[model samples]
Target chain A: MVNDNILGIIAGILTSLAMLPQLLKVLKEKNVDDLSPLMLITLILGLSLWVWYGVFKRELPIIYSNAFAVLVNLSLLSCYFLYRKSG
Target chain B: MVNDNILGIIAGILTSLAMLPQLLKVLKEKNVDDLSPLMLITLILGLSLWVWYGVFKRELPIIYSNAFAVLVNLSLLSCYFLYRKSG
Candidate 1:
Protein backbone atom coordinates (compact mmCIF):
# COMPACT_ATOMS: atom_id res chain seq x y z
CA MET A 1 0.00 0.00 0.00
CA VAL A 2 2.79 2.38 0.82
CA ASN A 3 4.47 1.55 -2.46
CA ASP A 4 1.26 2.20 -4.30
CA ASN A 5 0.92 5.64 -2.76
CA ILE A 6 4.48 6.45 -3.65
CA LEU A 7 3.91 5.37 -7.21
CA GLY A 8 0.76 7.45 -7.39
CA ILE A 9 2.54 10.51 -6.06
CA ILE A 10 5.40 10.13 -8.52
CA ALA A 11 3.02 9.63 -11.42
CA GLY A 12 1.03 12.62 -10.30
CA ILE A 13 4.11 14.79 -10.07
CA LEU A 14 5.33 13.78 -13.49
CA THR A 15 2.02 14.36 -15.22
CA SER A 16 1.39 17.58 -13.38
CA LEU A 17 4.74 19.03 -14.29
CA ALA A 18 4.84 17.61 -17.80
CA MET A 19 3.67 20.87 -19.31
CA LEU A 20 6.47 22.88 -17.80
CA PRO A 21 8.67 22.27 -20.81
CA GLN A 22 6.00 23.48 -23.16
CA LEU A 23 5.40 26.54 -21.02
CA LEU A 24 9.09 27.31 -20.99
CA LYS A 25 9.33 26.86 -24.72
CA VAL A 26 6.47 29.22 -25.29
CA LEU A 27 7.94 31.76 -22.93
CA LYS A 28 11.25 31.63 -24.70
CA GLU A 29 9.94 31.56 -28.25
CA LYS A 30 6.93 33.82 -27.70
CA ASN A 31 5.12 31.91 -30.42
CA VAL A 32 1.74 30.27 -30.00
CA ASP A 33 0.29 30.02 -33.45
CA ASP A 34 0.70 26.30 -33.75
CA LEU A 35 -0.96 25.56 -30.46
CA SER A 36 -4.70 24.94 -30.42
CA PRO A 37 -6.72 26.91 -27.90
CA LEU A 38 -9.26 24.17 -27.86
CA MET A 39 -6.66 21.82 -26.49
CA LEU A 40 -5.87 23.99 -23.51
CA ILE A 41 -9.49 24.75 -22.79
CA THR A 42 -10.40 21.10 -22.88
CA LEU A 43 -7.47 20.15 -20.74
CA ILE A 44 -8.26 22.80 -18.17
CA LEU A 45 -11.81 21.60 -17.94
CA GLY A 46 -10.72 18.03 -17.62
CA LEU A 47 -8.22 18.87 -14.95
CA SER A 48 -10.83 20.81 -13.06
CA LEU A 49 -13.05 17.78 -13.16
CA TRP A 50 -10.24 15.68 -11.85
CA VAL A 51 -9.85 18.06 -8.95
CA TRP A 52 -13.51 17.74 -8.20
CA TYR A 53 -13.30 13.99 -8.40
CA GLY A 54 -10.38 13.99 -6.05
CA VAL A 55 -12.21 16.16 -3.58
CA PHE A 56 -15.11 13.76 -3.63
CA LYS A 57 -12.81 10.83 -3.15
CA ARG A 58 -10.70 12.59 -0.53
CA GLU A 59 -7.59 11.81 -2.53
CA LEU A 60 -4.91 14.39 -1.85
CA PRO A 61 -2.60 13.33 -4.65
CA ILE A 62 -5.28 13.58 -7.29
CA ILE A 63 -6.47 16.92 -6.03
CA TYR A 64 -3.04 18.50 -5.82
CA SER A 65 -1.73 17.08 -9.11
CA ASN A 66 -4.74 18.12 -11.13
CA ALA A 67 -4.94 21.48 -9.43
CA PHE A 68 -1.35 22.08 -10.39
CA ALA A 69 -2.10 21.09 -13.96
CA VAL A 70 -4.96 23.55 -14.09
CA LEU A 71 -2.69 26.37 -13.02
CA VAL A 72 -0.02 25.46 -15.59
CA ASN A 73 -2.52 25.15 -18.41
CA LEU A 74 -4.13 28.42 -17.44
CA SER A 75 -0.82 30.17 -17.70
CA LEU A 76 -0.13 28.53 -21.03
CA LEU A 77 -3.54 29.51 -22.27
CA SER A 78 -2.96 33.10 -21.31
CA CYS A 79 0.33 33.02 -23.13
CA TYR A 80 -1.42 31.55 -26.10
CA PHE A 81 -3.72 34.54 -26.32
CA LEU A 82 -1.00 37.02 -25.53
CA TYR A 83 1.21 35.75 -28.32
CA ARG A 84 -1.30 34.35 -30.74
CA LYS A 85 -1.25 37.12 -33.30
CA SER A 86 2.39 38.01 -32.81
CA GLY A 87 3.35 34.55 -34.02
CA MET B 1 -19.53 5.92 -4.16
CA VAL B 2 -21.17 5.10 -7.43
CA ASN B 3 -21.43 8.78 -8.19
CA ASP B 4 -17.78 9.21 -7.40
CA ASN B 5 -16.90 6.46 -9.83
CA ILE B 6 -18.99 8.05 -12.54
CA LEU B 7 -17.34 11.39 -11.92
CA GLY B 8 -13.96 9.74 -12.14
CA ILE B 9 -14.89 8.09 -15.40
CA ILE B 10 -16.06 11.33 -16.88
CA ALA B 11 -12.95 13.12 -15.75
CA GLY B 12 -10.87 10.31 -17.19
CA ILE B 13 -12.57 10.54 -20.54
CA LEU B 14 -12.08 14.29 -20.78
CA THR B 15 -8.46 14.28 -19.69
CA SER B 16 -7.64 11.23 -21.79
CA LEU B 17 -9.01 12.81 -24.96
CA ALA B 18 -7.83 16.35 -24.20
CA MET B 19 -5.06 16.19 -26.74
CA LEU B 20 -7.32 15.43 -29.66
CA PRO B 21 -7.64 19.04 -30.73
CA GLN B 22 -3.90 19.53 -30.69
CA LEU B 23 -3.40 16.33 -32.62
CA LEU B 24 -6.00 17.33 -35.17
CA LYS B 25 -4.41 20.74 -35.55
CA VAL B 26 -1.01 19.24 -36.15
CA LEU B 27 -2.41 16.86 -38.75
CA LYS B 28 -4.29 19.55 -40.60
CA GLU B 29 -1.68 22.27 -40.40
CA LYS B 30 1.31 19.95 -40.73
CA ASN B 31 3.31 22.46 -38.72
CA VAL B 32 4.85 21.37 -35.49
CA ASP B 33 7.73 23.70 -34.92
CA ASP B 34 6.10 25.29 -31.94
CA LEU B 35 5.21 21.99 -30.35
CA SER B 36 7.86 20.82 -27.90
CA PRO B 37 8.95 17.24 -28.26
CA LEU B 38 10.16 17.34 -24.68
CA MET B 39 6.65 18.13 -23.56
CA LEU B 40 5.18 15.16 -25.34
CA ILE B 41 7.93 12.85 -24.23
CA THR B 42 7.49 13.82 -20.60
CA LEU B 43 3.74 13.58 -20.79
CA ILE B 44 3.92 10.16 -22.40
CA LEU B 45 6.25 8.94 -19.71
CA GLY B 46 3.96 10.30 -17.02
CA LEU B 47 0.87 8.85 -18.60
CA SER B 48 2.57 5.48 -18.91
CA LEU B 49 3.28 5.64 -15.21
CA TRP B 50 -0.34 6.50 -14.60
CA VAL B 51 -1.33 3.36 -16.44
CA TRP B 52 1.05 1.35 -14.34
CA TYR B 53 -0.30 2.90 -11.19
CA GLY B 54 -3.81 2.14 -12.31
CA VAL B 55 -3.00 -1.46 -13.08
CA PHE B 56 -1.51 -1.86 -9.66
CA LYS B 57 -4.59 -0.33 -8.10
CA ARG B 58 -6.94 -2.37 -10.29
CA GLU B 59 -8.67 0.79 -11.42
CA LEU B 60 -10.13 0.31 -14.85
CA PRO B 61 -10.91 3.96 -15.44
CA ILE B 62 -7.42 5.06 -14.61
CA ILE B 63 -5.82 2.32 -16.66
CA TYR B 64 -7.84 2.90 -19.85
CA SER B 65 -7.76 6.67 -19.63
CA ASN B 66 -4.01 6.91 -19.25
CA ALA B 67 -3.48 4.20 -21.84
CA PHE B 68 -5.40 6.25 -24.36
CA ALA B 69 -3.36 9.30 -23.49
CA VAL B 70 -0.16 7.38 -24.16
CA LEU B 71 -1.34 6.44 -27.64
CA VAL B 72 -2.41 9.97 -28.46
CA ASN B 73 0.87 11.41 -27.23
CA LEU B 74 2.86 8.84 -29.18
CA SER B 75 1.10 9.85 -32.36
CA LEU B 76 1.65 13.52 -31.57
CA LEU B 77 5.30 12.85 -30.85
CA SER B 78 5.65 11.09 -34.20
CA CYS B 79 4.13 14.05 -35.94
CA TYR B 80 6.44 16.35 -34.07
CA PHE B 81 9.47 14.56 -35.52
CA LEU B 82 8.01 14.23 -38.98
CA TYR B 83 7.25 17.91 -39.31
CA ARG B 84 10.02 19.44 -37.24
CA LYS B 85 12.24 20.35 -40.13
CA SER B 86 9.47 21.37 -42.46
CA GLY B 87 8.22 24.06 -40.12
Candidate 2:
Protein backbone atom coordinates (compact mmCIF):
# COMPACT_ATOMS: atom_id res chain seq x y z
CA MET A 1 0.00 0.00 0.00
CA VAL A 2 1.15 3.50 -0.75
CA ASN A 3 2.09 5.39 2.36
CA ASP A 4 -0.18 8.25 3.32
CA ASN A 5 2.80 10.57 3.58
CA ILE A 6 3.85 9.72 0.07
CA LEU A 7 0.36 10.29 -1.18
CA GLY A 8 0.19 13.65 0.53
CA ILE A 9 3.52 14.67 -0.89
CA ILE A 10 2.53 13.71 -4.42
CA ALA A 11 -0.79 15.48 -4.11
CA GLY A 12 0.87 18.52 -2.67
CA ILE A 13 3.46 18.70 -5.37
CA LEU A 14 0.92 18.17 -8.10
CA THR A 15 -1.40 20.81 -6.76
CA SER A 16 1.42 23.25 -6.30
CA LEU A 17 2.69 22.82 -9.85
CA ALA A 18 -0.65 22.55 -11.54
CA MET A 19 -0.72 26.26 -12.37
CA LEU A 20 2.88 26.44 -13.47
CA PRO A 21 2.03 25.51 -17.02
CA GLN A 22 -0.68 28.14 -17.21
CA LEU A 23 1.66 30.77 -15.86
CA LEU A 24 4.34 29.82 -18.35
CA LYS A 25 1.89 29.92 -21.22
CA VAL A 26 0.73 33.39 -20.35
CA LEU A 27 4.30 34.57 -20.05
CA LYS A 28 5.29 33.09 -23.36
CA GLU A 29 2.26 34.32 -25.24
CA LYS A 30 2.07 37.60 -23.37
CA ASN A 31 -1.69 37.47 -23.53
CA VAL A 32 -4.42 36.68 -21.05
CA ASP A 33 -7.59 37.47 -22.89
CA ASP A 34 -8.73 33.91 -22.57
CA LEU A 35 -8.00 33.89 -18.88
CA SER A 36 -10.33 35.26 -16.26
CA PRO A 37 -9.29 37.52 -13.40
CA LEU A 38 -12.14 36.25 -11.27
CA MET A 39 -10.77 32.73 -11.57
CA LEU A 40 -7.34 33.72 -10.37
CA ILE A 41 -8.69 35.83 -7.55
CA THR A 42 -10.95 33.07 -6.32
CA LEU A 43 -8.17 30.53 -6.54
CA ILE A 44 -5.80 32.73 -4.60
CA LEU A 45 -8.35 33.34 -1.88
CA GLY A 46 -9.04 29.62 -1.58
CA LEU A 47 -5.36 28.77 -1.51
CA SER A 48 -4.68 31.39 1.13
CA LEU A 49 -7.35 29.84 3.28
CA TRP A 50 -5.84 26.42 2.70
CA VAL A 51 -2.50 27.70 3.90
CA TRP A 52 -4.12 28.92 7.08
CA TYR A 53 -5.86 25.62 7.59
CA GLY A 54 -2.65 23.75 6.99
CA VAL A 55 -0.84 25.86 9.55
CA PHE A 56 -3.60 25.26 12.02
CA LYS A 57 -3.42 21.52 11.41
CA ARG A 58 0.37 21.52 11.44
CA GLU A 59 0.40 19.65 8.14
CA LEU A 60 3.70 20.34 6.48
CA PRO A 61 2.61 19.05 3.10
CA ILE A 62 -0.54 21.15 2.99
CA ILE A 63 1.22 24.23 4.22
CA TYR A 64 4.05 23.97 1.75
CA SER A 65 1.81 23.06 -1.17
CA ASN A 66 -0.72 25.82 -0.70
CA ALA A 67 1.99 28.34 0.03
CA PHE A 68 3.65 27.49 -3.26
CA ALA A 69 0.28 27.61 -4.98
CA VAL A 70 -0.37 31.09 -3.67
CA LEU A 71 2.92 32.27 -5.12
CA VAL A 72 2.17 30.75 -8.51
CA ASN A 73 -1.30 32.25 -8.55
CA LEU A 74 -0.01 35.67 -7.63
CA SER A 75 2.41 35.49 -10.51
CA LEU A 76 -0.39 34.52 -12.83
CA LEU A 77 -2.45 37.43 -11.63
CA SER A 78 0.45 39.73 -12.20
CA CYS A 79 0.92 38.43 -15.68
CA TYR A 80 -2.75 38.95 -16.40
CA PHE A 81 -2.52 42.59 -15.48
CA LEU A 82 0.80 43.09 -17.18
CA TYR A 83 -0.16 41.62 -20.53
CA ARG A 84 -3.87 42.30 -20.55
CA LYS A 85 -3.37 45.66 -22.20
CA SER A 86 -1.38 44.11 -25.02
CA GLY A 87 -4.24 41.77 -25.71
CA MET B 1 -10.55 30.88 17.58
CA VAL B 2 -12.32 29.44 14.60
CA ASN B 3 -13.09 25.74 14.72
CA ASP B 4 -10.78 23.47 12.78
CA ASN B 5 -13.67 21.69 11.13
CA ILE B 6 -15.11 24.97 9.98
CA LEU B 7 -11.80 25.97 8.52
CA GLY B 8 -11.52 22.66 6.76
CA ILE B 9 -15.02 22.92 5.36
CA ILE B 10 -14.51 26.47 4.14
CA ALA B 11 -11.21 25.58 2.59
CA GLY B 12 -12.75 22.57 0.96
CA ILE B 13 -15.59 24.54 -0.52
CA LEU B 14 -13.31 27.26 -1.73
CA THR B 15 -10.91 24.88 -3.33
CA SER B 16 -13.69 22.96 -4.95
CA LEU B 17 -15.32 26.06 -6.42
CA ALA B 18 -12.11 27.76 -7.42
CA MET B 19 -12.28 26.46 -10.97
CA LEU B 20 -15.94 27.17 -11.54
CA PRO B 21 -15.37 30.67 -12.86
CA GLN B 22 -12.66 29.52 -15.20
CA LEU B 23 -14.90 26.85 -16.60
CA LEU B 24 -17.66 29.35 -17.03
CA LYS B 25 -15.37 31.80 -18.77
CA VAL B 26 -14.20 29.22 -21.25
CA LEU B 27 -17.76 28.21 -21.94
CA LYS B 28 -18.85 31.76 -22.45
CA GLU B 29 -15.95 32.82 -24.64
CA LYS B 30 -15.53 29.48 -26.39
CA ASN B 31 -11.84 30.12 -26.35
CA VAL B 32 -9.06 28.66 -24.24
CA ASP B 33 -5.99 30.24 -25.70
CA ASP B 34 -4.71 31.25 -22.30
CA LEU B 35 -5.51 27.92 -20.70
CA SER B 36 -3.07 25.05 -20.78
CA PRO B 37 -4.08 21.42 -21.01
CA LEU B 38 -1.15 20.38 -18.90
CA MET B 39 -2.44 22.53 -16.06
CA LEU B 40 -5.80 20.85 -16.04
CA ILE B 41 -4.26 17.39 -16.27
CA THR B 42 -1.89 18.13 -13.43
CA LEU B 43 -4.69 19.58 -11.32
CA ILE B 44 -6.90 16.55 -11.88
CA LEU B 45 -4.11 14.20 -11.00
CA GLY B 46 -3.42 16.14 -7.83
CA LEU B 47 -7.08 16.25 -6.89
CA SER B 48 -7.45 12.51 -7.46
CA LEU B 49 -4.52 11.89 -5.18
CA TRP B 50 -6.02 14.18 -2.61
CA VAL B 51 -9.21 12.16 -2.70
CA TRP B 52 -7.26 9.01 -2.08
CA TYR B 53 -5.34 10.60 0.74
CA GLY B 54 -8.53 11.90 2.26
CA VAL B 55 -10.01 8.42 2.18
CA PHE B 56 -6.94 7.07 3.89
CA LYS B 57 -7.17 9.77 6.52
CA ARG B 58 -10.95 9.39 6.75
CA GLU B 59 -11.39 13.13 6.27
CA LEU B 60 -14.73 13.97 4.77
CA PRO B 61 -13.73 17.52 3.86
CA ILE B 62 -10.73 16.45 1.86
CA ILE B 63 -12.56 13.70 0.05
CA TYR B 64 -15.56 15.81 -0.85
CA SER B 65 -13.48 18.80 -1.94
CA ASN B 66 -11.10 16.84 -4.10
CA ALA B 67 -13.89 14.79 -5.60
CA PHE B 68 -15.70 17.96 -6.61
CA ALA B 69 -12.45 19.36 -7.91
CA VAL B 70 -11.97 16.33 -10.08
CA LEU B 71 -15.39 16.83 -11.62
CA VAL B 72 -14.75 20.48 -12.35
CA ASN B 73 -11.35 19.69 -13.78
CA LEU B 74 -12.78 17.06 -16.05
CA SER B 75 -15.18 19.66 -17.34
CA LEU B 76 -12.32 22.07 -17.89
CA LEU B 77 -10.33 19.43 -19.70
CA SER B 78 -13.24 18.78 -21.97
CA CYS B 79 -13.60 22.47 -22.59
CA TYR B 80 -9.91 22.82 -23.32
CA PHE B 81 -10.16 20.17 -25.97
CA LEU B 82 -13.39 21.47 -27.36
CA TYR B 83 -12.46 25.15 -27.52
CA ARG B 84 -8.76 24.90 -28.22
CA LYS B 85 -9.45 24.39 -31.89
CA SER B 86 -11.32 27.66 -32.12
CA GLY B 87 -8.36 29.58 -30.90
TM-score of chain A of each: 0.89, 0.88
Range of the 10 consecutive residues with the lowest summed lDDT in candidate 2 chain B: B78-87
Model 2: per-residue Cα lDDT over A1-87, one tens digit each:
889879999999898788677778778988787677887788788888888988887777778888898898899889888888752
Clashing pairs in 2: none
Off by over 4 Å in 2: B32-35, B81-87
Clashing pairs in 1: none
Candidate 2 lDDT, B1-87, residue by residue in tens: 988778889887776677777778778988776667887888899989989988997878778888998998899889888877753
Model 2: lDDT to the true structure: 0.83
lDDT of 1 at B9: 88
Per-candidate TM vs. native? 0.83, 0.85
What value does DockQ give for candidate 1? 0.65
lDDT of 1 by residue, B19-42 (tens): 788788889998886677877788
